[model samples]
Target: MSTTRRLRPGVPVASAPPPGARPVQPGLDELGTPLQDVTFVVVDLETTGGRAGEDAITEIGAVKVRGGEVLGEFQTLVDPGGPVPPYIQVLTGITTSMLVGAPTIAEVLPSFLEFARDSVLVAHNAPFDVGFLRAAAARLERPWPGFQVVDTVRLARRVVPRDEAPNHKLGTLAALFGAQVTPNHRALSDARATVDVLHALLGRLAPWGITHLEDLASATDPVPGDVRRRRTLADGLPDAPGVYLFRGPGDEVLYVGVSTTSLRRRVRSYFTSAEKRGRMTEMVRIAERVDPVVCATPLEARVRELRLIAEHAPRYNRRSRAPERMPWVRLTDEPFPRLSVVRDVRAGTAHIGPFASRAVAQQAVDALHATFPVRQCTGRLPVVPAPGASACVLAEVGRCGAPCVGGQDAAAYRPVADAVRSAMSGDPQDVVRTHAARIRTLVVQERFEEAAGVRDRLTAYVRGAARAQRHATAARCRELVAARRTDDGGWELVLVRHGRLAGTAVVDRATDPRPAVASLRAGGEHVPAPVAPATAAHPEETDLLLAWLEQPGVRLVELDGEWSSPVRSAQAVRDAAAAVAVALVAPPAPLVDDTPPASAPERRHTA
Candidate 1:
């Protein structure tokens, strides 16, 4: 069977660039579109070499079709204006002499573009053909109308398992699908076979609920038959904000997720090709049904999601579920208090960080210990020195106050504990200055290695202090209204309280933002007040809000409480100390004698 239709013989099958060229929006219809309503132009190219920049197109072929009917055909040969590599000449059956009088790429691209207009571009490996065409158009200074691209290769990979197809190569697919035309490495012949393969791929989409053009381009996985059978399970889900669970055999939960948009819509999407993640695909395959736990608002949904994940520890859930596992920089509540890295933030203990890693938390603790003579020994400390207790090397080196030995009692050590708590909560100016001064002293003594160590400790201290200050400021805020411009022309309003996002809303340019902002603030006030000892509140939620606030370009729209970092904080002290240290270690300026040589100036006179 042959699908090739020879266009008017010897006609110029390519067009030159139009006089005025402008970019065109990618022509794609809405998602969930019926395949019959979408037009696709299957394209193939024969080039001199693989690279678009280095190679030249020898021929272009395309078949424009809709609903299994060929709308038109385009074919052309071009003089590549360069020698075709010997291997390519034998491989493609197109020789230099055969293209002696053929038009150049500049003449071919415009016509090809015209033929494939208003259709999704389809190719076996879409990138190769599309890339070559785009490169050719760019080289000829022609504007490329960004066309929607669909790869039949990707479609075959999703539709047919690797065991069934052997491989996704165009020829293999053409034969497997029993195409009317065979791909012979010739542009037109290959394109026609690709069209057949495309139709076959489309036929596979209906069962997976891929009826739209938008869905086709983004589709990378086919919904497994078992997963599709459970699609109706999402039917009863309310279109509201909530957490949804995908449960597998034996009622075992496979995944848990929170949706700010329609819970039903988001849950339903998993059954289609929209969700491309490999793990998600596997989870869906085993999922017997979806269970939705609806919430009043998106923020509530998010909070509930975190709670559920922490409770269930679902296999497919990765983050925001293990808040208790995060490390905190805790100041032990003892008479001789010492800074330590603890995973669990307990009551009556002052803490700074819920750092991303324990290493960072330890670094912060080390920074504090370096600046203050705090005890570094672990375990319970006896009020008085025990007869057998031996001092650690740190205490021997004056890094600790030797509180374990009763060298410094609780009353005497209270000031040091107070300074540490103040530094950790607010400014660490004295601590940063102490590290900085030590760094300079070490540099002056030419103890370069020790100086670097001091500098690193100082840097860590300043960073920890800064992060703590930010978190404290956020935690102290009664309410905060912040806005960040979204990708779409709209503003995303974030309502934060005690460092947790209380509520969120989006205001479009078409709406009166002030009213929405006011309404959001009013609703945000009703969120459950944070628990006492702020650390007891969800640190994950607090961390999430902190991350958002820390992102560049987020604007503070309004704040019910003061939101500020210490201007004369440890960070400032570190900068000053760094400058002094750099100057102290700098090479001495070349010496200049203050006393001039005792030489008289001589005058010459002409007679």
Candidate 2:
């Protein structure tokens, strides 16, 4: 006999196990449902032959049940519209004469479908019965109402041992489970026996937390030997939104992920064949343990997953594992500040990006430089310039104030620095429009290649500016609480601080959520005003929170500061920027001569 005790509903299993024993874990389905709330329709079919296309159904029997109580029963004989083969008569004891007065498949199907509505279909061998019904529907020129079918045979294989049950065949399972009715090769008797088998299998799965209809339907897939042995690694895992890691030999991290709903289900899914990625499959094969960290909200989980990936640099993680390498556009805090692409963001500096790459950040910088006379020199000059100081070509062409050569004093260069900072700070449309006008002038001159380069630079600037606006909006908030009604009759509450997710909770509509929100606020982490690297750890967190804030049905409950975005939608900004480029590149009108015409022009309309 197995030494493991049955898992109680709502109680967590032990995290550690005794030596030489496997740990018992709950099922991946976290949504608890009382078995009484589930409806099942046990069905059995007797047909002319095994092949659905070549044969016809002779009889159909079904029992609708809830919590072992029979709600209703359906039994009928179907006429094949042809003679029943002699062999079918011998096997089922159903003859051609017996079905002579039976209703045709078309006549009986509608009523049978109605009886099974809103119930999970159950059969000993589901495919055999379901296949014939589909065939019958095709012949009747009617659409089949696809039903969620459960096979008792497959369930038996999972729940009962082969040695104990002999085999998963109907008669063997019925006898093994001591079913209320014996399988006698008749539709009603076979269906009644399968119903008892289903109940027995469900009881066996109760410890695994398989109580819901969805879990029941999907539980039949056999767990591979290697994965089954490590099932204990999931013991005591909470069914909440969180991050999980798969560790291999020597405790090396193999993979990282976040689950918005149930972490258990998401982690367990990796070991199943449904994961088609070959690298992931190999990772699972070598996995030694599963470590999970639960978060109050999915947003927090996402942020944590990214941080963990950056920390570990696991081989299997494909994205966001190198947060340190993402490029940023930083304005150096020097006398005659110039835009520079840097890997690190410092405090008290105006910065524009955590662009996807350094090249993209440079493109934005280049575009802004083309329109504004910002310094392009890399030198750090003092108030008193040294004699014979060299000047870059940008200063010679009037593209810069020549601060390096002391041609322009710091007082005169302040406006240029302020313009660059303002253009980068809020509403970059001014810069875009100016550059767009330049591009239009070039286009009017038929400078196609030059126009293309300017267009690309404009595109990059708009995208980076939109992202920076969102980041700034999130960074400005000290605390925010919002709620939305979920489809499952519950309210989802999310708390955000600065930009990161602080907490989340789902509560029924009848319950007051004020206390939870208050507690979250009292215990939530406070983020200081937006600075450089501190705000750059998880850029995606800002994106996710922004998306959630914009979703329909979301209502703001509390706020420490006003949440607003100065930047418009990326597409709108891009269009406006492009329009500006068109105007700039247009040809200038010819200058008119100062000399007036000898005779005054005549007016067509007389007063």
Candidate 3:
């Protein structure tokens, strides 16, 4: 049997503010109620089964505390109107006979609700106990007070290191925190044990500045003391859009990032609990100082951040560190042109990718070969076939034109070469039409797996070609100016030269933007002409610019060169490929199951 400490008569509990009256607001330093001033009702429940509505709660226990002082306790057994399952009987030591004369839930609900009024509820896996109580209230047609609940199990996972406690089970945490009372099967003993665990967790969180009630609610994985101390490093940073660099002791750049909001707040967050990434935490510890490069617009800041990450190849930054490593599919500059994946761009050659990987680029090549009779052999083929030269197995299977063995001379293969060149540069309808027909044929033959493979290859080719053509058109222009209206009714102007962001400026809504545009043009970076198939800036940087330019409400202020894709461009192919993909992955019809599902079995503990 667990003991109950009844509430003293005439003691008033706190209530909500009167209707329509404004509540008093706390100061910044007192943003939330201090943890010590909060009243907590630690609770546990013993139930006949795991479910709430379907089963019933057999016993209820709770302890009320404030400022570490025990104010009261509540414990009771209720008649569940049914027999307790034998497993639950063994688990909770509450037999069917023991609940025979106990008060029904209808009789016990009012007293328990009054005991827990105006307090934050605490529990190990709170949903299990609180859910049962709410279900009971629903059954009685009583309006259950919406109490703020906290789960100590969730709090322990954040506060206690896994090394100190192997798991966050109630029994495990109770023992780890040295609780005064050991939890048995009974309700009150577990509630008493949970109170001690809750206090110990609060103590551990104090050093991390989680001293307030709202802080406890929002607290995440603990930020180290050293990391917290370094928050001061962000003090002098300006509150504006910009790029930031974290520098190590040797002044080597460790990481580069951009912020569209306040640089100071963003940098400070790196040292706070919100930055939960392990690699970022390690980077912060190694970082010695932060350097800010404030920009006039968020786009400029993003572009500059990409450039810096590419230049420094920062060890701590995972993305855009090696933009130069991206592979492109180039039509080799030879008498017999063939697709080749190359890293560096040359002055003159048709190219079709900045593919995500070599494997994807190769797939695109396969799609082209399946459609065109371009040679698949790697070695350079002579203008004329040698006397004893032999054609490989590809020629035997009609997959290649076999120009190496005079099956088709360069003159005869000119139309095939021209078709492949057209597909790579201007018109891709031939490849798209060929692939669609083959896919349909495969599907008719019920070769779904083969059809899917062809679909993926076609998708890779079309998407990569479309992206490449879009990039090339923009990169070919000498200078382009564009503008978009900002949220504050100002204009954000940008000067781009050969796909590189040369300059950016923000103009006030009241002021004329012509002078600012002229000034930006005069002061912009001097970018030289880019070699064919290569953008003046990194492909990633150009990609960012293209995306920005394509956004709604953007106006083209000026242009120096024609920027256009072909009439039957790869964009159309891309759309067709998307349709094929949808048809390929469509789910099959669902099967009907006529038999009823069995009820879930009761468990020993909700935890």
Candidate 4:
């Protein structure tokens, strides 16, 4: 496709510098240009060697552009006096026999340099190629051109990333982009790919307010592409605990996550980390940049995350509508009183067992007895153990009826396990439905709060019903066992294929609220919840947290089938992430303040 029409009106592109003129800094003139109009040239070179300082150039090709419009093109082949190395000749299909009487760098250098005048230099592996040109300039006693250069390799990693591929070699990129590498290894062929890659890169950078040539040319080393540009912003982040934002280009918000230590490192890892493979690649694609807001402590990061989430309402953030009204689990203080789902697990009268993974906590009631059994372990049966007249382990101690051991009927233990499951799931509706028939027995003789708790639990279930609507409807929600977190958590879902999602389930639930939500909502197979608080300093915990947090950089999150099982859950995440990435690719909508008119100040929270 012609990129000129898609130039975003006047967006700057990485174009080759004019020939026979010294390279100059790009973008400065764009700033000086009318409303940021400037020329750009996507440049490419093919040579007989590797080292820019020592290699001999075989071909040079470039595309000159102004304000997103192609003005002209330049290409030429130079002869190297010495015979080309065997490997070099094989790789590039160039031969000393073909270059019998070609012009030397001394002759072609002037035209190429002059043509590049007042424009930016661009190459697939820009540094390697630009390095050679710079060295050549120095060898000729001319100062190396001060022209700005754009690295399409860097741009490809940011614009269109893939975890399977390490460095974005021209061939690797061409295969994925499907852009024909007709004249592979030839400067003109590679130059065409450079131009195409530049166009894709420009589209990716549009969201970052990176339009003018000078803006792209003057960028620091690596010419921060879409996702990698986050590195620069990450530098300002402190290692201490803090919240971070993954911003799309043009200052659009992508994702909001928090960390306890090494905020900058964590953020940097998301862009460069390797473990982030399998989902999250889409964010890397749209993420032309990132901007971080640091905090001195983790507590601060939590508060900050909540506040930012409230403000940004990042499409990728958790989808709870009313966090303050979300349900919580309530376990009575009595030795083994029934556990109830409530609105405040932290507020009052509730011994808040830390929120755990959906699977761990759901199946945890039994696991807990396995760890510490007691007179407090049973629901209907009394806590005393009986003699060996066929008693189970818990029954051996009078704790359980030992249905599995044949002490009691399966029917007898069913209700008990069901209650445990209900409690773990925080399903107040189940509690009410199961025990409502007993209401008449405790009728006027009861503590109202206990009964009221049941009513409130039912209400929470009802309220959450509407919220149970699926986000990834296209994700096979019917067969999917999704996590129903109350509130406060984030998930990393990778979308690998153009229309499909792939990869592992990276559920990061911490002592923090958002993570708590993520833990509950991630329901595929069973990944055991963290044993202690996520604050525990274990290497596995740290590594897992880091893997989920930044995704080890964008390229790594391709949602590939590297991690298997939990297919439904993985699809759920990938579907959600793809939905968000799609939104990011388009323009962002204006933020409308949801607050009510000042005359009705109290209604602000009603939404």
380-466 per-residue lDDT for model 3 (tens digits): 888988899998898899888889998888788888778887888766666666666666666645565576677778878887788
Ranking by lDDT: 3, 2, 1, 4
Q: What TM-score against the true fold does each predicted structure earn?
A: 0.46, 0.53, 0.60, 0.35
On lDDT, the leading prediction is: 3
Cα lDDT tens digits for candidate 1, 1-607 = 1144432111111133587887455444432445677778999999998998888899988888776677888888889998765335535667677799999988878778878788889999999999998888888788989898998877776777755866789889888878889897789999999888887787776566566676675566556687777678789898888899888898987789989878999988877777655567777778888889987556557777877887888888766567767777878987678778877656565777666678877877877887778787777686887887777888778877788877788888888888888877655656655665675566546565566556556665666565555566666677788787766777778888777766788777677677878898888745444322243246666656777776888887777766664444543443433433333444322112224354522221111
Residue 108 of model 1 has an lDDT of 77
Q: All candidates' lDDT scores?
A: 0.72, 0.74, 0.81, 0.48
Cα misplacement distance, residue 411 of candidate 2 (Å)? 2.3
lDDT of 2 by residue, 113-155 (tens): 9899988898988899999888888888888887878888777
lDDT of 2 at 156: 72
For this target, which candidate reaches the highest TM-score against the unseen true structure?
3
In candidate 2, list every pair of residues with a backbone clash: 27-208, 436-580, 436-581, 437-584, 440-585, 440-586, 441-584, 441-585, 441-586
Off by over 4 Å in 3: 1-220, 434-453, 573-577, 581-607
- Looking at model 4, residue 284 earns an lDDT score of 60
Better model by lDDT: candidate 2 vs candidate 3: 3
Write candidate 4's Cα lDDT for 1-607 as tens digits: 1233233332444455678889666564444332135566677777766887787778778777665556677777778667765334435656566787878878888887788798777787788888878877788787766887778776665555455555477777666555534436778777776666566566667666565554564322332255555456566677676777888877878788788787777777766544233235456667655666766434345545765776677866653323434333344433234444344433223222222222323232322233222223334433332444344455666666564334555455555645543433333223233324322233233333343333333333322221121111211111211222222454433321211121223344553434433443353233322221111112222223233333333233222122222211212222222222222233332122334376643211110
Q: Model 1 reaches what TM-score against the true structure?
A: 0.46
